[model samples]
Target: MCQKNCRGDCDCESQPMGGGQRGTKCDVRILLVGEPGVGKTSLILSLVGEEFPEDVPPRAEEITIPADVTPEKVPTHIVDFSNQEQSAEELSEEILKSNVICIVYSVVDDDTIDRITDYWLPLIRRVLGEEHSTPVVLVGNKVDLVEYSSLELILPIMNQNQEVETCVECSAKTLKNISELFYYAQKAVLHPTGPLYVPHERELTDKCKQALTRVFRICDFNNDGALNDFELDRFQQKCFNTPLEPQALQDLKALVSRQLPEGVREKEGDPKQGGLTLAGFLFLHKLFIQRGRHETTWTILRKFGYDDSLYLSREYLFPKIRVPAGTTTELTEKGHNFLKMLFEKHDLDKDEALCPNELEQLFSVCPVVPWGPELIYTVATNERRFLTKSGYLAMWTLTAALDVTKVMEYFAYLGFMSVTNAESQLDAVTVTRDKQLDLQLKQTMRNVFHCRIIGPQGAGKTSFLQGFLGRTAQETDEIPRAHLPRYTISSVPVYSQEKFLVLHEIDIFSMHDVLTPPELHCDVVCLLYDASNSKSFEYIARIYKKYFEKSRVPVLVVASKCDRSPVKQDYSVQPEEFCNLHKLPPPQMFTTTPATAGEPAKVSRDIYIRLATMAAYPNLKRLVHVLQSRPSWIGEYTNQMMELPPEVTAWMKVGLGAAAVTVMGLLLMRTLKNANTAN
Candidate 1:
């Protein structure tokens, strides 16, 4: 196919000077995401040899040129952006257009793991729609700090989920991981057969513009090209200005006041320069803008023509000019005026601009606790909240402020926070009592214990619980007096500082629910089986396999109603044999008898003590005590037939139903309105 022979050196390095082809077709796009100050830009610089700034700024720019691999011969390009100033939608749009994704986490900080799972990963999935479209790599950046246990702990959690392609622990600063990270990202992009199609600027049409406009409306102030303190101040003020009672407002304000303030440590001379600079204005501006939100903000800034050195050279008007760390090369008087105008235009009445502390207060109302107060403060003072689980939780928790503590604590417990100490074996009177505790006995009621009761309708599962509570089942014989396990447990409300725990159901938890990232190893699991019903044993076995497959905990297999069948030789499988097969402790089999069964109730007392002794963690006990001490409002509404006039009752029902419907309708309308505005 060669028409003309290639000339000297001929640029014929193309195809060995034989064929007339330029090169093999290979293209790749990679996105950088990580926590702040993790050397993302430095690592990128080392790999690509492109000088990037420390400070981040709004707007997107290409930061790297195509590089060819020596051995693999894969052509690669990186598209780096920040989550600081853009919404998840906007960020997703950018990522969706890319071929490969790199999620960076600093091994020094355990918090980054949550950010990757709860925030960044979810957003990526939403954009990519399929996990395979863009291969993801969970990067443990800053390998120099890998000695920390938190880093060790973090890697396990990421590995447990098994979501990412591969995890690499490398140091961007030491250039330890620089080459490896590039290799991994390039590998992910090449895994798929087709090339990643990145659209040109024309793709962001009028629709995207409208979407961006609304995002700007929430972020921008005074119709300026950039964000400033005034816009941030207003946002914080609006959050605290709830339509609640005065006492509530005061309480809310007190909580808000505990947050970090804006510009507090921002203007302390730049790290490289000894003198203060007005570049602090640009720093603050970036901090107060959206693109300034994530760890990659600095990387994005380098692409946008700003760096830390320039920020240090500019002079400041205020003794403490607060600005984001990396944004402006130098802050001029003009930058100061642009920022000042935003304050004048939007926050004329407010004296204080949004600070880190105020932003924390503002975020407290979200339903899910944001990743941390630092991120929220950064968002409010600096105008961006990095998308992370913490950020999502913070926003959710703040907005929902209703019983958030309980949800957070439960999640923490599940994460495996030590809830209680193990109980010591003590001598007790009941013959059934032994030094060894049963599965249900070891985990105090304070811990999360799941028990399944199986038997015919006549079985004693409900009877056993009622008798343990010292309540007679006969007074209300038609309806069992046994207390059903509640979805959540709550302590009585008090304005006391003494720390306490609350238990709640997991079903109602919102996306923003602030979960405590602690271990929640289950303490006890009990499978109650009736000796009279052989079928009950099958059910118990199934429930055990389903629930306790992942949980490493003590299990008790209780053979209830031994009095009915008189402990047959093969009455259900042998407890010891069952335990041995499952690699668990031997079962605790006992006969349970109620007055109706014509058997002595003395055995019930012995079993109760055995169970209580095994499950005795202090925290779990306190939770039980707290639940037992609840106010009357939480009492079950048992009255079915009312003594009031039928007409009055009917009217009451109608009124309540109407009110509920109206509220629901209003909420729907408000949601629709907000959606339209955002669109």
Candidate 2:
């Protein structure tokens, strides 16, 4: 058979072709292209071979990769070219001749990254013919610059087209993702020998095959060529089919066995058993099978511990706080008990097993506010990559609330105490008993002004909280008889006290639901944005617009990720612009860098003092006026509510007495607490 020469510039003059390498058919060619400095040429050079160049030359070249399945050459051909000033018409002429094309951009360069589709694709389509399903790979180069990359855009754009074989981010300088690019591209272009591409995950593909292979080996016992009717029937009955449906099991076995590799007859000796051995079958399964959905199973394993074996025995299963590595994990006794309670309380249908969707619905009910996409995505993936530190802290707060007997009962006490408080006069913040916070700011956080911290993912919202607490604790170490507990929304203390409530990355929906009237409400809102990426700045709108009207309180705009650089909150816009843009007063900004080796860095006392000052502004006048009225005004409430019993009245008197003693201590009224109170 004769094949035409596709990329030929010359033709033979009526010459009869002889059987030789020169008369053979040409292989399909492909082109790789990108901006001038985007490593288009380097990728081809590495795949083929080239001599070392002392300095990079400003030129282009082409190389041929021969096809061979033998122990020698691999089948691949790549043409490397530059796209510095090429027009769409010229690039189209080049692309039409190639079977595949790759579009590359630096992931960190927002300008070039956006142009891949905006500038390149239309040109390619106009010149090369869109009717042809010519596979294209969107390559995001320089992924090592993760902090600088626009995740908001990258994730959405990559998700736009599922038909795209793979969206990859690689750093050419580090050679991080080069191999994966080649592997994925090769798989997308079909191979004549077999199916391609095995997923990197373990349980989804690898473990499933191991289980199947074990069953296959058992059916093929006695080193026979294949399983007979009795053996097949026994296997089906043992695995999934039941004994009551004997004929159905028998028929299903016959159907499955036929799909097995051919040439192996049901005899002791046969040539068809070449790849049918247990190990070979297992290998082939791993090499070819698609990974099944197993996020739920994996989540369970992660929460518990995977025991050494993927399969578990009933005995090794017990709840340990930490999951054991290298094993199929079993739920602990506590976990089992918790599951039983959950099923009994929530699942009215009473199905013995609950799937992932059901489990998510159950957890969602625990939140006072409805969960949003970000929180739902985190729950579904069962992996923590998408969750920020602040989000985790918010979850921790909720978990602590659940720790008490009832959720509403706990929040009622929390709600009541957060509303009222007395002022403290400590010059600085300090720590006592290693667990309590004893800063002057606690009085303001709980009693004076409402404060909230908000920010984008990884903008150091949690770290800022840690810094604030640590600094305040250090400042008031000299104060005797002072104890302030680190405050969380879930475990907020009752009684006439003040504390900073650190609510982390709150999902906007959840916050709104909780803050609705006739329920829990917040006094202030903090709007945080990331400094390194502009998209974080835009996200500030989504949070503020949702809750600003409901809050009717001051909103402080915090630009997080400030440690990447110094804080910059000064915008030229005036108050009208703020209203036009729906933004709060530009936040009082702060930046922080990591501590150096062997040096412990705490929050500066100056920042804490400033924060305390701002927080104390709202209630200082009211508190001072009430203090001026003194003993008469304070006792008015106690005297007016005459429905109280004598014992209850006595308890109230004791509480008032304690408050008076605390007030005297603050005012230096006496050297001690009456020296002998019982007397």
Candidate 3:
């Protein structure tokens, strides 16, 4: 594909295709269409020979211009159309395939020039459709035969048709404007004026404005609504591969200011806060198009990942990714770091959570905020129901695991690649190894774990899931619980790394209700019950005996609403005894009540961490069995040590430290008293 026949390496792997990383046209096809006797053949020959040809064929063989010879570093194909040799069907096929068509007419022949509008233009349109985007370049050949310029007659035709990009008058005999003619043809394909500008309006098109606006915001690193000298220089270097000199930068500022006074502003206290405002940025690009330099604007647009249609390319938003079954998607360390930076920067109130206003500001770069009101109840938030830092990361983590493609798209909309200087959002995401492989290795490196909470009615399961986000029962009750989300995800630190635990509240109306296989399929199971309800324990006890009798999936019995008075179960074996017999951990007590306002909530993380830890380490039951096989005294001591809640251990340390200090104080007092007696 890279030879004379090709004239280009468009099929090369490095070249970006449509909507890819660097948006660009790979090759240009220039097809010359005209009446039989126009100098269409002569123009092609003159461009190759640099001289008028004495003999012209009915049609010239198709020519391929090498990329090095073209002005735009793009290979070009030039084809000549003949009415005698090519049928109308063949001409239409060429019109469909060509990027730009050159309609050649004779400068001295009135009839031939008239046929341009009456015949060629309509012909091309009929083939490509009336609203086709393929550009048309009008060429007037045999200019030496006319003493006067023919542009006067061609001017009205151009004004009347939006498809005509430009008209060039040249003499194929004298080679006058011969090279200029084909250069315009190449320009028609490379940087057409229709999409970027409107000649009559003398302004950038609305679509062009939007694409540039996105580029400007991405370059505005400080979110100051302006591009300072540093940002401007970076933008220049990024798009053009060259930075501007100091004087050039000043000249640009002056140019925008001269055109529109408000285009550039001065911030009194902060010079960096003021540079090229959004208005100025738009004005500069508009000015470039007005001056016939739309290629410059197109360059900036493509560099920032906009295709010809002014939409982000697929390759830019959803880079190549594969997640095999039983595998999961997760954010990489860089992704986590970028999100942390965004949270810290946007938390203007510094309450460690984003209020609605702050959340809007953070997503201002995106076209629309992707997450909606349901996000409030799906993740952990502060007392005001605003998303907290952990909640923010948890939302992202949950998205990455569930719909990773959307994560990539939002990353693109959020300017992840631009801000991180990465090639793609792939650096921010990763596909974890399959769970089957993880099980074989007896260890998993996944940062997300799922726990399905199955409990009878009135077991406080709804409140339990909400508590994962630190929401109290009262807070949950503040609003109608009609469609309250059943899933609540929040970050739980397991030893060293932060892991996201997704609590799915499974509604079980009765103890004997059937549990489906998919319902039981999870990393861990939570048998939640109300500590105040005597019969709550029995519902889960029968559930455990029926469904998860000998399954490898770890199960934890959680006694929720522990803030209420304790009650005994009316089952064959009580909760603690049942756990011991099954080699499972003892029933854990949980409550979000104490977390309400002035109450201690140190133990709130205990149950969540245990659930997540069990999910992470599914072989914990085997470890318990090994411990039970050891000496009874050793087993008892190990169980006691492991079962102690972190809050209890902290209080034990505090009491012991206080006792030691009191003994030292007594010694100090005795020494003082003895010294005083001696005196």
Candidate 4:
């Protein structure tokens, strides 16, 4: 029966109307279109019943089943046109009557897949007209026979060729991914969000652009340039099959209002409250696509009261604070109790202080803010070695309120009196601390250097570290397992010149771990790889690209376990070649074995000393100061300037006395000679 005005010549509108209308029982008409022998019948039978037909007759059939399996409990109409012969006109009429279309191809035969673009897609497009907006799903059957990777190559082509919302691969025989495929198709029809438009790669095609334009024109009744709230609701229902919620409509309004120009709101017909212009409509679509519709930008928008949920709950907005039983006698006491709770939660080991790891966990749980190890060490810990409970409380209170002086006084009353000391006394303490730090800095500069060694599992990283520490492979008890990170400080000087603290760990793979503060500040980074295993080298390369490429610190690459293979294998990449491929410097190569005992140790020591020296005196200014301030240089300069030889002094005195006597004699002689000459 036709629900609207329909001509009897075409049966495109023959299906019952309002079957899937919102807030009622959903009845979807799904059309199955594909090349011959693509298992369309088997897929349909699998979806509707348990048995696969041993023999499928060449016929056209319709199976109407109540599908209580879905979350919505909607009935689905499955039309199988597997072997039916029809003219182009008949096919076009059938296509128009469908709610969703699934185009299937056999994965085993690449030719069948090619015909999807060459034949099936073009016919559908020609019949439905260029501006039609029905959703399409591309299905790859017989996935069990072909490698999944083989099917991946042609998926993008299908997506580009048609209004393909999603592509899925399933085996009707094994029933793999069949249910998921149908669910996606149902979603595409009911909640028809338009095709995603990624900025560079996935863009809206001409067809999509035209469809959207037509949609906008249809919604803009009276041919107005904009759409009001009523118009928008109508548009949402007609285009997406689902009406916008009241909150959703308001959010759309708010978004449009914020985007308008300042004076435009005060114009004669202020568009802010009047309607959304065509330009505004396009802009919102682009924004929703570019920033993902949900995770990041949408989440932020909801927090600002743009969505149904007014804002993030208090737990998500603020850190958890628990009040102690008797600590709420006063308001200040209550606040202090809250602070104590926060510190206790973060101090997982219950040590009353936060280690580097514990502090990182705390920062992650707190409301979104700028965080890093340097900030925690400087502001929260007041440049101290660790953050205590009192320090955490003080930092939070100062930031929470506008009156910092009053907060400091309150803290002083709570036994943090040093915080309220006189400015002069504070200055003295600061100067003394600075001087002490300077001395310690000089000592560290002369004594120790830090290196962080990182690599993949079984890359011989731990073995290399053990060798450097003068431990044999047989002494397994002494070596820590590679799965866990280890920290070791060498008391003895490496290369008999520089001491080193080595932090050995695997590469960080998760986002949570990456946000945390590192336990130590390293002067140099050492990347290790096993020469026998090519995969280890590849892992190191990926690590460098992901993490180390942006770093300004010096990175030293080490090729370990060279002794495992006497001759270079074809699979193994030479250290120089690997470095060249990555545009990095050539690495230091070493072999740690019983036969080559003490050789790797010496080489490791040399590498450490060279890296540390470069890190410590990276520029000429600091190097010059260190040299000029050396005790030996000062003593040598003082002795050279203040001391004189006795023989040279005696010679100087004799020469001066003789010069005076000679002058007197010469004057007397000159006078006698002058008088005689004058006479």
Q: Count the backbone clashes (under 3 Å) in each candidate.
A: 71, 17, 0, 0
Candidate number of the best TM-score? 3
Q: Per-residue error at 663 for model 2, in Å? A: 99
Error of 3 at 587 (Å): 2.4
Q: Which runs in model 2 stand beyond 4 Å of their true positions?
A: 1-28, 46-54, 69-74, 84-87, 144-155, 191-679
Q: TM-score for each prediction?
A: 0.24, 0.27, 0.83, 0.30
Kindly list the per-residue Cα lDDT of model 3 for residues 466-528, writing each as its tens digit. 777766777777646655887789888777787889888887788688888667767889998
Which scores better on lDDT, 2 or 3?
3
Error of 4 at 599 (Å): 99
Q: What is the C-alpha lDDT of each candidate?
A: 0.40, 0.41, 0.80, 0.52
| Local accuracy of candidate 1 as per-residue lDDT tens digits, 547-649 | 5544533455667666666343343556567666775535555653456566534434444433332233322322222333333432332133265678876
- Candidate 3 residues lying further than 4 Å off, grouped into runs, are 1-24, 269-273, 344-352, 436-444, 456-458, 480-483, 509-521, 530-547, 561-574, 594-603, 622-679
Model 4: lDDT to the true structure: 0.52
Show the colliding residue pairs in model 3. Answer: none
The model with the greater lDDT, 1 or 4, is 4
Q: 562 in model 3: Cα distance from truth in Å?
A: 4.7
Stronger candidate by lDDT (1 vs 3):
3
Q: List model 2 lDDT by residue over 1-679, tens digit each.
A: 2233345532332222211112112444556777667667666554443332334444346665555631112344566665554665667677877655677777766777667668666666666555444556667776766756555665555445322444667665567667666544543332211112223322224444443443453345333434555554454344333342556644433443455534224344732232244443343344343332132222222122122133321211211122122111122223223334444433434544334454443443222323344342221122222332333333323332222222222222111111111011010111121101212122322322224665555555544554453432233232232232222231122233332243334423332333333122333455666666645554555556565544434455555545566433334443225544643333445555456799764454333333333333322312322233346656686675466888888888888889888985664433122212311
CA RMSD for every model?
29.0, 27.5, 10.1, 28.4
Sorted on lDDT, best first, the list reads 3, 4, 2, 1
